[model samples]
Target: MAHRKVGFGLRGIGHAVVNGVGRLGYASRFFLMILIGSGASFRRIHLTIREIYFTGVMSLIIILVSGLFVGMVLGLQGYETLQKYGSESALGSLVALSLVRELGPVLAALLFASRAGSAITAEIGLMKATEQIAAMEMMAVDPISRVVAPRFWAGVTSMPLLAAMFSAVGVFGGYLVGVVFIGVDVGSFWSQMEAAVDFRQDIVNGVIKSVVFGIAVTAIALFEGYDAPPTAEGVSHATTRTVVTSALVVLGLDFILTVFMFRGV
Candidate 1:
């Protein structure tokens, strides 16, 4: 009985691994197709803009509010720690570096995944369930170009902008707390931040990270929705998977990108 259980467990592991690889392969092909058909989105432009409105504009309230809160918390924590070391003037550098280098891109991406990514998954999944995609195929309308490509491009374009807004608003929140509420010197705060946060090193790298995350999140969402079983339960499950998988992928990619970008620092 013990030997049989071991054999069954090993077989299950193997089967899971094989299935995972197959799904990955299918996703890769799907991503390639989106890239190939992306030209249509650009040619029309309005479709991409409409998707941006849905994914990016609609997400602003949550992103801005979250960024503000996160910044306030960072300011409080950083000020507490720095005061102990008599380096309170360095508060600006601390907050700015934290946001621009890591927090802004990562937190924004996670939020995007939870909000817009899940929505995209649900939308496409429902379309599939209703046979809209099939009807498009029958009509030779090229659903990928008409539907998926615009969304994918919109995500890729919106992510970096959202991240930038998050970081900028976070900086303001930090300023409000550190300078206004806590009575930290405004000159020292801005000066230290200006000195430490390099444009090329920190800002550009953060943008790159956001863009990569956008592609990962959107692609995962699209694939899950497209591949969802044509049922309500399947669409719900696929939406859940979109959020979970995108979070994991974003964190993993952030680590890898940080290693490459900030190796010594």
Candidate 2:
């Protein structure tokens, strides 16, 4: 009996492993199709532009407000901490470094995932559920080329701009609290920040992170939608999954990228 149980358990484990690999293979095929389809889909620039308007413009207000609040908090906390050491002039370095190096890209991606990622997943999932995707296929249209590619490309393009705006607004907010509210010297705030925050090291790296996160979050959103079961419940579940999965993937990628990008620093 014990031997039989062990054999059954081993078989179950192997079966699970094989199933996971099969799913991974299917996902890879789907991803490859999107990449190949994206080329000709560019001709549908109008559709991509519409998607950008939906994803980027619609989300701008929230991103702007969140950036400002976060910057203000950082300014207050940084000033309070540094004042104890009589290094209040370093407030600029602190805020800029925090925002550019880490907070800006990560927070923007998180907000994007919560806002636009969920919407994309829900939209695609609804199309799948309503048989719109199938209808396109029945008409000999490739759904990936016609539907998914444009949205994917739009998201990849929009993320950097959104992140840059978030960082810029956040810096201004920090300036308000640090310089005007707290009486920190304006010259030290700007000059110290300029001297310490390297465009290449901090700003460029943040942009790279935003780009990588954008690709990752958008890819996950599209995948979840495409793979959703053709049911209302499935569509809802995929939307939820997009947000949760995007968050995890962004944080994981941020850690990995940080280790590689700033290891020497």
Candidate 3:
């Protein structure tokens, strides 16, 4: 009995490993197909643009609102913490560094995943469930080019702009709290932030992070939707999975990228 139990456990582990590797391979193939089809999809720029409006424009309000509130909170927290050390004036550097280096990209991506990513997944999953994708395939229309690639590229393009907007709005929100409300010197607030936050080191790296996150989140959304079972329950599950998986991927990728981008610093 003991030997049988041990063998069963080992078999389960082996099966899990194989399943994980198979999923990875499948996702990789899907990604490659998107890349290859992107050129042809570009000619249908109008479709991509419509998707951008859906994915990017639709998410802007929430992103901006969240950014503003987050910045204000950071400013308040930074001021209170720095006051103990008589360094309240450094609030600008604190807020700027926090947002530009981490919050801007991570939070924006999270919001994007929850909003646009889930929508994309559900939309595609429903199409699959309704036999729309099958019809397209039968008509010799490449769904990868017609459906997936455009959405993927739109997301990739939208993320950096959204991150930039988030950072900009966050800075303004911080300024309102620190400089106007709390009486931190306005000049010092802006100047200190400018001095400490290098465009190349902080801003550029943040943009890079957002771009990577965009790709990961969008790719997962498309993959889940494409792989979902052909049923209403499957569409719902895929949508939920998109949000959960995208969030995890964004966070994990952020950690890996941060390690490489700011290793010594």
Best by lDDT: 1
What TM-score goes with each of the models? 0.98, 0.94, 0.97
Better of 1 and 2 by lDDT: 1
Model 2, range 216-245, lDDT digits (tens) per residue?
988989998999898889989999989998
- The per-model lDDT (C-alpha) reads 0.97, 0.92, 0.95
Residue 177, candidate 1: C-alpha displacement in angstroms: 0.4
| Candidate 2 vs candidate 3, lDDT winner | 3
For candidate 3, the 10 contiguous residues with the lowest summed lDDT are 38-47
Across 11-65, the per-residue lDDT of candidate 3 in tens digits comes to: 9999999998999999999999999999865897999999999999999999999
After superposition, the stretches of candidate 1 with alpha carbons farther than 4 Å from their true spots are: none
lDDT over C-alpha atoms for residue 247 of model 1: 95
lDDT of 1 by residue, 1-265 (tens): 9999999999999999999999999999999999999999999999999999999999999999999999999999999999999999999999999999999999999999999999999999999999999999999999999999999999999999999999999999999999999999999999999999999999999999999999999999999999999999999999999999999999999999999999997
How many clashes in each candidate? 0, 0, 0
* Alpha carbon deviation, residue 39, candidate 3 (Å): 1.7
Residue-level lDDT for 102 in candidate 3? 98
